[model samples]
Target: MVTQDGATVTARSIDATRDWLERNLHSTSIIETERFGFFYGREQALREVSLGIPIDGVTAIMGPSGCGKSTLLRAFNRMNELYPNTRAEGTIRFLGQDLLKADPVAVRRHIGMVFQRPNPFPKSIFDNIAYGPRVHGIRHRAHLAELVEESLRRAALWDEVKDHLKKSALSLSGGQQQRLGIARALAVRPTVLLMDEPCSALDPKATDRIETTTRELAQELTVVIVTHNLQQAGRISDHVAVLLAGGVLAEFGSTRTVFASPFSEQVADYLSGRFG
Candidate 1:
């Protein structure tokens, strides 16, 4: 039997499971989780999950609804702490220290997040992108302008909004707004970017734009995205981590490997549309 905290899979032998993890857990990992768990008041949201996020490339955390995908993503930057009566245990190492133990503000500066929906501040496009760097103490106009333009360009939003820098960010389309949100996060120059269903609210064309931007961004930054769309994950992610009901990490490996040869029947079923 293989057991992780309270989660168990009797069908998988402990030795086999260990072997599989050893093979997939890359040595160049930038973020490592060790028996991590999170709680909300009296309820447990994540239980004894452990995995490695590579230094560069996109990593998709996928599972069914209410499987703690977003919860885990939030935990990385200690955003979970914003909720009352919440707590986390175990280690989430980034830069060789437990991120859970680090200051939330400091952690957020290094690990930026984009939400499921476009939520730009009711400010101009320039202000939206410049917000983070300004808060971080870049007071010079030229510097802020440089950061804003660089961020927008990095998010693939510069060409579309460059001439309308003073316009309200809310004026953009759903996809443009989402990309604006991404640019805002990038302005802080985070080493890692966390995206939670970033394309869920957009149309196909917008989703395609976001997907393209994501692939390009992965070339320079480590991106950890939470998504339920299996095909999207397969198309963009370098690694895939499948979380089961109750936040159990059932399978994790390169996207190609996991999609091609799932580790267990449950994983196979989940990938095949037989079950979530």
Candidate 2:
């Protein structure tokens, strides 16, 4: 067969192309996982998953329900341990450190997480943003204030909540609350941010704002987001990893390449809404 570029295509050629792309795309990755596996008791949620998240761009992990998209994202920061009987295998390296063996608290400090739903503390907006900093030992009021402002600004929420800093965070709209959650995560000054379907519960307008914030955040830190929305992934991700239902990574590459010409039939079918 021949591609639209008029180049002859064969199974061998396709494999070679994909292999080359994978090998070269993540040469300077900030996080690399090799033969990684995760188990919740006896059931494996992730199986031999391998991928590299670049240091300066948004990487979207996409898959159908129960495909371990969130499982892999949480593994980066050791969040999986929150569940009983959960364990990880193989290696996950973050900045050359063995992430699976690293101190969970320190790993979390460097890699912040934003969950599927906005979960702000039942405190004032300012307090919500200041909580992480306080946990990290920033007790000076002035310094905490500065960090709060900076974090909110980074989340694109400072302008809206600037005058309402004393108000309860729960009073904010769903979108605002989500942005507040992002701001709270940023207060710790993490090098990487992991978002698990952050916009899945928001409306289109809210999703757009989060996407904009994500793009801006990518300028300063590595971002790995788990999203089921294919369009959202295409819009915000520089790289995309598609996981199959059985905890397998079916295809991973630049967003353009994966969406336009997936190497795996499973990825193609999933992207085309055939099975997913």
Backbone clash tally for model 1?
A: 0
lDDT agreement with native, every candidate: 0.85, 0.87
Candidate 2 lDDT score relative to the true structure = 0.87
RMSD of 1: 9.9
Give candidate 2 regions above 4 Å deviation: 1-27
The TM-score, computed over Cα atoms with residue i paired to residue i, of candidate 1 is 0.90
Candidate 1 lDDT tens digits, 1-276: 111211110122223434544566535676889999988988888899999887668999999888899999999888888889998888998756678767777778778899999999999999999888877777888878988899999999999999999999999999999999999999877778999999999998999999999999887778999999999999899999999998888898999999999988888999998877
- Cα lDDT for residue 81, model 1? 85
Clashing pairs in 2: none
For each candidate, give its TM-score against the true structure.
Answer: 0.90, 0.90
Quote model 2's TM-score. Answer: 0.90
Pairs that clash in candidate 1 = none
